[model samples]
Structures are given as structure tokens and as C-alpha cells.
Target: MFPTFPHRKWYEQRIDTMEELEQHVLNAHFPEDAYFRGMPSADFICISSFYRQYLQDNKDSLNWSEQQVGIGVTMSLPEVGKQQYKESSFEILDYFYKCLRELGSKELSFNSIAYLAQHYGLPTNLIDFSADPKISLFFACFDEKEWFTDKDCTLYVSDILWHVKAMMPSNQTIPMGYFKHPTENRGMTEAEADEMMFNMFTTIDKDSSETVTPKIELDEVKYSARIHNQKGVFVYHCDDVPFDRIMHTSNCNDGFNKVFVINKELKPKILEKLNNEYKINEKFVYPDVEEDPNLDLILAAAEKTKQKFDLP
Candidate 1:
């Protein structure tokens, strides 16, 4: 499936910048360490991009390898012999995807693929979603120690309306499946939702800040609960659960559930207090806050919490 395009000429013409370098890293299909074996960054981006387009366009027909069910995506371009590297990289990605399909529905995890790429001395080009071109996809690979088959992974898209309504200060919108309710059909007022989300954030921020080292895991529950209560629905691994019902789940006491109630019920009042207490837009950035260092801290906290919950 390799194209005979003059990829080398393209590489020589374009000068890579820090921004491009970061994008290349973020859009990578595998781990950062995987392609570190003297592979030109530009070449990697080109190859990864080629494979990504291929798989996305042919998702239905693609299959995993005999034991691999996950596919990695990324891009790279380097000076000198760009065409050869581009061709070889495309072949590698194409083969990788074919291998996953042949594996027959095995489990896979993002981290697993990342580890695999790292193991092979290939740059995985894993993207930091917290950064610019936030939605860019990237390269990856498989590692026995960290690899999880495709069957093990669950995909969830976040609700857009939920975020708009929540008026989350960070304005961190989840991708399509993150919500339990139908964001498209849910008729919620954006103003009210934002107020509710603000309250939830303030509460969680207050709680976390009070601790010497904030436990983001505990705050996420609070955050999730706030969204659930305000939206009247909470999403769990793509399942839409009513806010009240989610409260009854076995793990509801995990602190997240409890905070959910607070967020919905008291968010408005909380927001009012915070509005009076702090300057607007001072606490957190929105819209284009992904590059904000403060927002990065919040994200770091969230990641730490994820680790605490042992969530994949």
C-alpha cells in the first residue's frame, strides 16, 4: 500500500520547528522512545500520517495481527533520503495494522502500545493531549510487559453540551463518549450548566487545595458527580447512568459519587460564592486553556488521580 510520491523532496523543503516537533511527538502512533534509534523526526511524521489516514479510511476492513489487536499511529519527517524512510515507515505501519487485525480481538491499552513501541527502540510519538493540536493522534507499538490486547480497552467520548453547560473553568471538553447521557438530545441550558460546572470545580479545587498534596482521584469523583447531577446523567465507560442511580452503584462511595450530588445541588450557590471571592478567569482558563501552565497542573492532578484509581 506504499505510494510512490516524492516524500524526500517534501522533507528537504520544510524546516521542522519546536511546534512541529511537539506536534510530531503528539501525533505519533507509538511511544517517544520507539523511533529514537536515529530515525529522522520528519520522516517519522510522514510515515505515521500515511498509516493513520490509511487505517482511519479503511477501519472496517482492517484487522489485527495473530496476537495483536491494537494499532499505533504517528508521523515523522527527516532531512536526507526522505523518500526511502517515508516508504519504509509506511510499510511498517501498514504491516502493524494488518498484524493487529490478524490477532483476532485481543485486548489492547494505550499504555500497553506505548510500552511496546518504547521497547522496540522505535519512537512511539505519543501525544500529550494537554498540549496544542490537542486532538492530534500519534504513533505507538506493542510491548509484552505493558501491552494490553484490543479486547481490554473501552472507548468513551465526552459530551459536548455537557461541557458547554457545565461552563467548566478549564473548559476541558471530553471527546464524544465521556458522557452517559445523549449530549445531542439532552436539552440543557448552557448558562445553568456552566454555573453548575463552576460550582463543582470550585468545590473540588477547594477540597484538593486544602490537602498538602491534593488527591486528584478524590476530586475527579467530585467533579464527575457534579456533572452527573447537573446533567441528570453520568457516563461510566460509555454507559449512561442516571445521576440518582449512579449514587447506588457499589463503588459510589468512592468519593466521586458523593461529590456528584454536591455539584448538582449546590453548584449554583458555590459559584455565587466563588464569583464574589475570586476574579473572573483568574482561577482557570477556558476556550484555549490547553497551553496554560495552570491548566497543566490541573491535568497533572487528574493524571495522578487516574493512577490512584488504577484506571486504564
Candidate 2:
């Protein structure tokens, strides 16, 4: 789940002093846009003051290292882009619309504009709040898919931050690494590992209608799979085509692919036993189609290979 802003004044009051407040802010490494969007100048100053006071009062509960507070007050502001409108309400609404337009052009999927509004510190539930009604209407206009994802249903808020950062003239967007530590030992595998891994990757979600469903189907499956031998599992079911390919296609950047760490060691003969005894083939059902034994066999082989090695 995504982290949320503190709601209680006591929680807010616990942080005190410039040094303490600065340390908290640095540790957050919060995006510039999120920081400014969540707190305007007056609010930012107030929060910082309160945070310092809180920290001083509750020193027993908190401890900081020199490395943790290395930087201070170098925080950047969220990109509001050009402030075309003078009215605060209208400016906020227009900013949101601009974000939607930009993200839409990039073919990004979202779940809820509400999350974006909140991230920007706009009044999310404004009917009872003092914000303009138009702000709420703006959020209502976009579909949930425009701002949310299955992971957190939070309006793809992180993507919005990324988009804003990418738009900056000097901002260099670095994609965070998506792999586990390379040196971690997963275990050994036999000669037929690749084929087995592939089969396992294909079979794990064989019944997944979203993966194998035809494009014309109302709920089509648009995914691919990869076996992470080190991780010992099949990483499947990605939303984006490129991401799916990144996992399945050979020779892509190693960082973007999903990894499955195998947790157990097995002999080659175990593959045959799993195939016959588990009837693993029966589980490899294609979306919107009858079962195919050949595909099942292939998938079973991959799964078996994925399980070839166990990590301690």
C-alpha cells in the first residue's frame, strides 16, 4: 500500500527543529512535485516547524545517523508547469487536466484521478470542503483506468510524478532497478533448464483469461512470461506490451525483467514424475479455448525446470 499523509495534529506536532525536519524530508526522498503539491509554501513551513518540535519532544522514540541527514533543504518543488491561470482553483484544475492529457498521449493507464488530486494536495473530497465544484467535476470526467492500477488503486500517482519529472528541462529521469541482488544464490540447474523454465512460465497462468484471451474479447489477456531461475518462480502477467516483452524476450536489459527464485532442488526425473502424477497438463488451459495436451506438456516442463534448484 502507498504511504499516506499524517492526519492527526499530534503526529504532525511530533517533528521539531530545522535539523530534525530536514532529516525527515531527506529520508523521504519524496518527488519534488509531490512535496509541493501536497504542501504549499505556508503549509510547508508550518509542517517543517511542527515536525522539528515533534522530533525534539519525542527524542527517545527517534534516532538519526549522520549519513541519514547528509543533505538539508535542497528539496525541489513539484513542476506546476506554466501557471496560465490566476485563480488558485482554476489553476489546480487545469494542472490536473494537463497531466491527464500528457499521460494519455504516452499511453499510460490510471485508476483514479482522486489519488492524483490528493497527491497534489488538492481537496479530494471537496463537496463539503471549501474547494470549487469544478475541481470535483474534473476528476469525474476521467475513467478509473485513466489513473489507477491493480497494485494500489491509487490513480497511478507514481507515474504522474514520473511524467512531471520527465517534462522538466534539466530533470534526468532514472528508471529504478527492478532486480533482486545478483550475488544471492538461488541454486543450480540441469542442462534442460531453459526449456523447462519457459514451459513453467507459460503454464503458471494458463487459465488466466486476461493473458490468453483474444484481443477482441472484452477481457483479453495481454501478457507474457519469464522464468527467473535465481528467484525460482514464473513472473507473468504484465500490463504493458513492452514490459511483457522485456520479461520474455531474450537479450533485453536485465533490469526490467521479472524474476522468480526457485526454492527447491529436484532431479531431472522429478519433471517426469510431476508431469504424470500431477496431471499438470490439465491445468494449462488457454483463454477462451479448450485444453491442449501438447501446450500443457510444454508448460509443465518449464515449471519443473523452475523448481530444479532450492535456495536455502
Clashes of each: 79, 39
> TM-score of each candidate?
0.17, 0.16
> What is the per-residue lDDT of model 2 for residues 184-253, given as tens digits with 9 covering 90 to 100?
3323232233333333333312132111111111111121111010101111222211111211322223
Clashes of 2: 39
- Model 1 CA deviation exceeding 4 Å by range: 1-44, 49-184, 187-312
Candidate 2 has what TM-score? Answer: 0.16
Q: Worst lDDT window (10 residues) for model 1?
A: 234-243
Model 2: weakest 10-residue lDDT segment is 224-233
Model 1 over residues 170-236: C-alpha lDDT tens digits? 3435523322233443554444445655444323111221101111233232322221121111111
Error of 2 at 310 (Å): 3.0
Alpha-carbon error at 52 in model 1, in Å? 11
The TM-score measured for candidate 1 stands at: 0.17
Model 2 stretches with alpha carbons more than 4 Å out: 1-157, 160-298
